[model samples]
Each structure stands twice: as C-alpha cells, then as structure tokens.
Target: MTDALNDDRKGWMSLLAKAPPARLAALMPDLPDHALLRAPEVGAVMVRGRTGATGAPFNLGEMTVTRCSVRLAEGAVGHAWVQGRDKAHALRAAVVDALMQTPESAGLHACVLAPLAAEAELARAVRAGKAAATKVDFFTMVRGEDA
Candidate 1:
C-alpha cells in the first residue's frame, strides 16, 4: 500500500481500537457478513514506555489484549488488536477495518468514523483543558542583578 493509504488506515485502526466498546457498537452500522480468518483471542502483551519521550524504552507492565482477523466477502482482509478481552469489540473492529478499504468506505467514514473522531477530539480537549487549568507558570521574576 502507498504511504498515504497506509497512514489513513492506521489512523482509523487506532481510533477503532481505542474507542469505547459500547459506543462503537452503538454507532456501528449493519456490517456485511465476513469470514473470520482468526477468531477473537485474548492474550497479554508487554507494555513499553519511554522516559521523557526520547529515552530508552522500558517494560511498563503486561496488559490484556484481544485480537481478531476477518476477511470481507469482497476480498479485503482486516485485523484488529484491542485492549481488554472484549471479543465482540474485536470482531466488530476487524469488520470495520475490512470494510474501510472498500468502495463503501466513504459512507462509513461519514457515519461512523467521523463521529468517533469528533468525540475523541472533544474528550481530548476536555482533558487538556483540565490539565491546563492546574498548570503552574514558573516564570522567573526580574529579581536578578540585571536591573
């Protein structure tokens, strides 16, 4: 796949994985039947983190994850890895992932992906706002021997 296409797919996949299960289900449309290449399976993955966003990575801890793979009737294959052991969520996410590559993607983007992105952005903004409210400005006063 081209870089642009791959990046676009990556964006939606991340969004779907992080989306709330019940909310994603509610916004989901009538998905076409698909063949499950891999049934939903739960597993644990080691979480990694970097200090100061540039330091060497360190193992944070283990996290529960669920993954599923599906092939759409139209030939597109999709896979999903989501946090937690929500089998249904993984299945639905995989289905969406497959469908997003087809011609019907425009409608799905408008109806499902758009709202999810909006909600995610709004929630992020709210969290940022809360954090900003408590921010401490450490501006050094002009008390040095410069005056």
Candidate 2:
C-alpha cells in the first residue's frame, strides 16, 4: 500500500479534491446494485491565491468543485470530484466518499484511487514541463556613473 502511495506523485485526496465530475464518475465503479450510494452535487467554486516558489503572488483562478455524500446499504460513505462540467466525476467522487469512512478505504485507496492519482500526477507533470519550456526570463542592468 505504501509502495502505491510512493509510486503516485499526486495525493489520493488531491486527485479527488479538484477532479472533473464526469471523469470521476466514469472512473469510479458503482456500488452494489442492491445498495445505492448518493452522488455528489456540483456546488459553488471556491477560489484561493498563493505565492509561487519564487515568492511572487498570483491568482490561481477558480476551480469548479462539487461535493457528494453517500451511504452504502452497508453504511459506508464516500465522496470525490473531477474538474468542470462532469457528472461522471461527481458520481465516482461520491463512491470514493462513501468508501472513505469505512475500514475498506485502505484497500480502495490502494486499488482504485492510487492509480487515478498517479495518472493525474503524470498529466500535471506533462503540462508543467510544457509550460516550463515556454518560460521567459528578463534581465535589466543599471548604469553606473564615474566613481
């Protein structure tokens, strides 16, 4: 289990934290047919800002966030998310949500969530690499008078 955690660069909670609802739904399998799990609803987007590694402050833009809470017939609750207009992601998030409150979360995190987190990290890394390639540096020199 720890191996899986180390292998995945992105945290499992992070993968679920700002995911697209549709993608999440697609990834997450449905609970037992006899047992129904509630799906999460698309809620308000929360915005936050922070300084980059260089200590320059910037607005990080908004994330479309949805929250879902569900109770399995067996009484387990799971919740999850994706990014942007995504019902599938929301559904899957709810499944994860329901599983989280149970002892089964360890197994679920290892099997289901870890892979998703790893994939997300890979995608993020690719995007970061691409963005980094385009970074521009500007330099200015000050002129000095006679000493």
Candidate 3:
C-alpha cells in the first residue's frame, strides 16, 4: 500500500482500537460465531492519556484493557482485548487473528475495520461542524467618549 493509504489504514485501525467491543459486535456478528479451541483471558491493564483537539494532552482515568488469545478449529491462533468489560472485543480480536493467519486479512480489514473507521470519521466530522457553528466570538470596541 502507498504511504497515504497506509496512513489511512492506520487511522482505521486506530478507530477500531478505540471502538467498544459491543459496537463492533453489532457490526460484525460473525466475530463471535467462531468456535474457540482457546478463549480470551485478561492479561494487562494500563492507564492512558486522553488527548484534546490540536493534540493537547490531558490525563484521563485509567482504563482496563484485557488481552486474550484463542485458537480456532482450523488451528489459527488469534489475540485481542477490549476496553473495560468487553468480551466481544476479545472474541473479535481472536477472529481477526484467525483470518489474518489465512489469506483473509484484506477482506477482514475491508469488511470490519474500514466501515468502522468511516463511521467514526463521519461522527467526528459532524461533531466538529456542530462545534464550529456554535462558536461565539467576543470582542470589545473602544469609542472616543467625553475626555
């Protein structure tokens, strides 16, 4: 892939990274259908920062990130995690893993990550536009009065 497209894909991945497992589950039902020879188990939790517009840094509360690994019936191993209590994320991550081990990475990326990314982008754009429209400019003008 070209650098621009790669960057776009990264953006898509980032959206998927932040996505809640439940949301993803609604979008991709097949994620949870795979028979898990292995199942997801919590591995780690870490505190992360919340960034503001213009990349300003802000400290947000710690988030719990669970990681798990699973093996499908076809002998493909996958790993994934969800923020908070999201089992769906772990399941989907495993499915993606199994797909990646096969020749289905492109399909998974397109069907799952791409649409999620597009939706996220649309939501962000809408929010930005709304905020911009509501912006209020304040100014003070001085006039020559009795002196």
Candidate 4:
C-alpha cells in the first residue's frame, strides 16, 4: 500500500480505537455478514513508555485489550484492537476497517469516519482547553539595574 493510504488507514483505526463503543454502534448501519478470521478475544499486552517522545522506552504496565479480525465476502480484510474487553466493539471496528478498503469506502468515510473524527477533535479541544486553564507561566521580572 502507498504511504498515504497506510496513513489514512492508521488515522481511521486510531479513531475507531478511541471512539466510545455506544456512539460507534449508533453510527453503524446494517452490516453485511462476514467471516471472522479471528474472533474477538481479550488479552493483556505490555504497555511501554518513554521519558520523552524520543527517549528510551520502558515497560509501563500491562493493559487489557480485545482484538478481532474479519474478512468480507468481497475479500477485504480488516483488523482492530481496542482497549478493554468489548467484543462487539472489536467486531464492528474490524468490519469497518475491511469495508473502508473497498470501492464503496466513500460512504463509510462519510457515515462513520467523518463523525468520529469530529467527535475526536471536539474532545481534544475540550481537553486542551481544560489543560490550558490550569497552565502557569513562570517569568522572572528584571530589576531596574539589570534592565
């Protein structure tokens, strides 16, 4: 796949992962039946962290996650991994991923991804606002002699 396509898929997958399950479910219309290549299963993955964005990574902890993979009748395959053990969420995400690769992806992007992106952006703005409200800037006033 082209880098741009991969990036686009990554963006949507991240959005799907972070989206609220109920909200995502509400946005989904009737889905076509597909075979589950990998049924939704709960597992723990070791979380890792870095002191800074470029720092050496270390194990942060383990987090419970659920993953699912599905293949559509038209041969599109999708996969999803979501935090927590929501099987339905995983299934839905996987299906969406697969569908997004098809020619009819435009509708999926409109009906699903667009709203999720909006919601995610709104949440980010709210969070940034809250953080900014508490931000403290430190400055040292120069004495007359120093100035």
Candidate 5:
C-alpha cells in the first residue's frame, strides 16, 4: 500500500479501536464470510508513556488487551488489538479491518467509519468540556514591597 493508503487505514483502525462493539455491530449486522486466523484472546501489553509530551519514554504499567485476526473469504486479512477483555469487540474490529482493505472499503467508510469517527469526536468533546469546567486558573500578584 502507498503511504497515503496506509495512513488512511491507520485512521480507520483507530476509529475501530475506540468504537464500542455493540455500536459497530449495529452498523454492520451482516459480516462477510471469514475465517478466524487467530481466535480472540485476552493478554497483557506493556503500557508505555512519556514524562511530558516529548520526554523520555517509560513503562507505565501493563494493560489488559484483547487481540484477534481474521481473513476474509476473498483473502484480505485483518487484525485488531483492543483494550479490555471484550473478545467480541476484538473480533468485530478485525472484521471491519478486513473489510476496510477490500473493494467495498469506500462504502464501508461512509456507512461505518464515518459515523464511528463522529461519535468518537463527540465523546472526546464531552470529556473535554467536563474537564474544562473543573479547570482552575492560577495567578500571582506582585506586592509593593520596595516602595
């Protein structure tokens, strides 16, 4: 795949990872024929973080993650790793990932990815609003000590 296509796939995969499984199932009721290359399984992945935005990376901790891999009948392969122990979420995400690589990708992007992305953005906005509401501004004042 070209760099542009790879980038686009990354965006869709992110949306799938963040999306709720039930919501994705609702959007795509019928999945195309596929074989499970890897059954959904829960595991731990080392979570890493930086002290600040660009600071040195450090191991934050271990997080529970579920992963699955699927291959469509037509040969497109997909894989997914989602946080938590929701096996169904991982499976559904893998299916979507495979579909995103097929010729039906455009239609799926419009019908599925677009809505999921919008919902994710809305959720993010709501969280940001709540955080902003609790934000406190700090300031310091200079006193006329030498006058």
Candidate 6:
C-alpha cells in the first residue's frame, strides 16, 4: 500500500477502535457486497505496556478482544480487532475497513470517520476537563534560616 493509504487506514482504525458501539451503529452506512473471510470471534490477548514510555515492555494482563475479517466483492480485505466481546462491533468495523480501501473511501471518511473523530475529540475534552478540575498544585516554603 502507498504511504497515503496506510496513513488513512491508520487514522480510520484508531477512530473505529475508540468509538462506542452505539455511536458506530448510529452512523453505519449501507453494507457493501462482501463475504466474511473470518467470522467475529472473541478471544484473549496479552496486554503489554512499556515502562516510562521507553523502557522494556511487560505484560500488563490479558484483555478480551473480538476480531473479524472481511473481503469485499472487489477483493479488498479488511481486518479489525476491538476490545471487549462485541462481535457485532467487530464485524461492522471490519466491513467499514474494507470499504475504506475501495473507491467509496472518500464518502465513508466524510460520513463515518469524520463524525466519529469529532465525537472522540469531544469525549476526550470532557475527560480532560474533569481531570483538570481535580488537579492539585504543589509548592515549597522557604525556612527563615535560609535568608
């Protein structure tokens, strides 16, 4: 794939993975002609984390994930792995992924990804506001002897 296509795919995948199931359902477009290359399946994967963002990676724990794969009639294949056991969400995401690789991608990006990205940004802002409300500041007092 070209760099531009890869970048677009990455952006859409991030939005899809973070989007709530209800939100995705509300914006779902008409399904394209496709075949389920791999039916949605729920499984566990080892969640890994890196220390201080640059240290050695370590297994955080096992997380439940649902994954699905689909192949469009035009031969584009798409895959999705989402957190939780929502098979429907995984299937929809995979279908969208496949569609994004086709000529209809521009429409999908505008109708689906744009809205989802906006919603995700709004949700993040709300969370940040809540966190900021409770933020505490620390200071040190100088002793008289220090004069």
* Whole-model lDDT, model 5: 0.91
lDDT to native, each model: 0.94, 0.62, 0.66, 0.93, 0.91, 0.89
**Can you write out model 2's per-residue Cα lDDT over 9-60, one digit (the tens) per residue?**
2355567766544555555656543233445566556565557656765767
> Best by lDDT, which number?
1
Better structure of 4 and 6 per lDDT: 4
Model 6 poorest 10 in a row by lDDT: 25-34
Q: What TM-score does model 5 achieve against the real structure?
A: 0.86
TM-score of each: 0.88, 0.57, 0.64, 0.88, 0.86, 0.87
Candidate 4 displacement at residue 106 in angstroms = 0.4
C-alpha lDDT of residue 19 in model 2: 55
Assess candidate 3 and give its lDDT.
0.66
> How would you encode candidate 6's per-residue C-alpha lDDT over 1-147 as one tens digit per residue?
899968878888878877898889889945777799999999999989999979999999999999999999899998899999999899889999998888889988899999899888999999999999999897768868896
Model 1 Cα lDDT, one tens digit per residue, 41-69: 99999999998779999999999999999
lDDT of 3 by residue, 53-132 (tens): 55766655566665666776666666565565566676676676566556667887788877777787788999999999
Q: Candidates sorted by lDDT, descending order? A: 1, 4, 5, 6, 3, 2
Give the residue spans of candidate 4 off by over 4 A.
Answer: 51-54, 137-147
Error of 2 at 145 (Å): 12
Q: Quote the RMSD, in angstroms, for model 5.
A: 2.5
Distance from true position, residue 22, model 4, in Å? 0.7
Q: Of the candidates numbered 4 and 5, which has the greater TM-score value?
A: 4
lDDT of 5 by residue, 1-147 (tens): 999989988888788878888898899888789999999999999989998968999999999999999999999999999888999889989999998888999999899999999999899999999999999998857658854
